[model samples]
Target: MNVMEIRNTLGASVLCAVMFIGITALPATLAADDDAPARETATAEPPDPRLVSRGKRLYVFCRACHATEEVKGSKIGPNLAGILNRPAASLEDSLYSDALRQQDFVWDEEKLDTWLLRPATLVPGTSMAFVGLPQEANRTAIIAYLKTL
Candidate 1:
């Protein structure tokens, strides 16, 4: 082969080698991207049954002060029997805090969770002297139990 032809062949081989390396390396690059820790999957899991049971057990602590029975004017705190769906300050004959009575809010899971986390923060100038449940799991359990009420 001529000198020019030989040189051209060598250049072509070098180019081919570089391309092969690049192509082979692409999969590993892609795999690294794929293998990166997966993003936390957003899920709405049903409330744990054990949590609900535990909440029910813990609720006995509250029962002395707050009656779960629907019969109104029967406890230190308003009867919480049907509190889940009720309006925030709609309890009749129950002296709710001025702050709570002024605010228009419905008691729901989300609101309950926040309230349970910090009652004073959730409703400023509230009369609920009991400090809120701090642990998320316990709060969730208590909320589940409250819903059953």
Candidate 2:
């Protein structure tokens, strides 16, 4: 092969190696950055069946306005398949209240807990109509179920 061709091949190989290393090391690098938002695991260990079952039952209240799966798409609320660690009101298509869209935050467990306890309390003008889950246990179960979705 010509020297120019060899040099180009070597440069391409080096770029690929750097990209691979960067991609593989991303999680560790992100973990060490205190300012970075923590990444949520999508392949977490299976949630307890009992907890999921209870949550599914409790989710009836949510089902009226929300759809969990994407194919079912957004109803009154947005699809929640990957809600955990997601930014508030980030979905491009779904309509959100000014109160919710104006705020900035990721939806972690604590936030979800508070949101479950009281939607309006979390985002005063959120369009969601469900009053709130007064019981912590019920909220926990529902969160667990949501993680599976």
lDDT score, candidate 2, position 52: 91
My TM-score estimates for the predictions, one after another, are: 0.64, 0.68
Residue 149 error for model 2, in Å? 0.6
> Would you list the clashing residue pairs of candidate 2?
none
Q: How far is 114's C-alpha from truth in model 2 (Å)?
A: 0.4
C-alpha RMSD by candidate, in order: 11.3, 13.3
1-149: candidate 1 lDDT, tens digit per residue: 99999999999999999999999999999997876655323443456788789999988767877888675454767788877878998977787878999989889989988987888998989887778788898888888888777
TM-score of 1: 0.64
TM-score of 2: 0.68
- The lDDT, on a scale of 0 to 1, for candidate 2 is 0.88
Best by lDDT: 2
Model 2, span 1-149: residue lDDT tens: 99999999999999999999999999888767854434344445668999999999999988978899878878888889899889999887798889899989999989999999999999998888878999999999999988878
Candidate 2 local Cα displacement, residue 17, angstroms: 47
Task: List the global CA lDDT of all models.
Answer: 0.82, 0.88
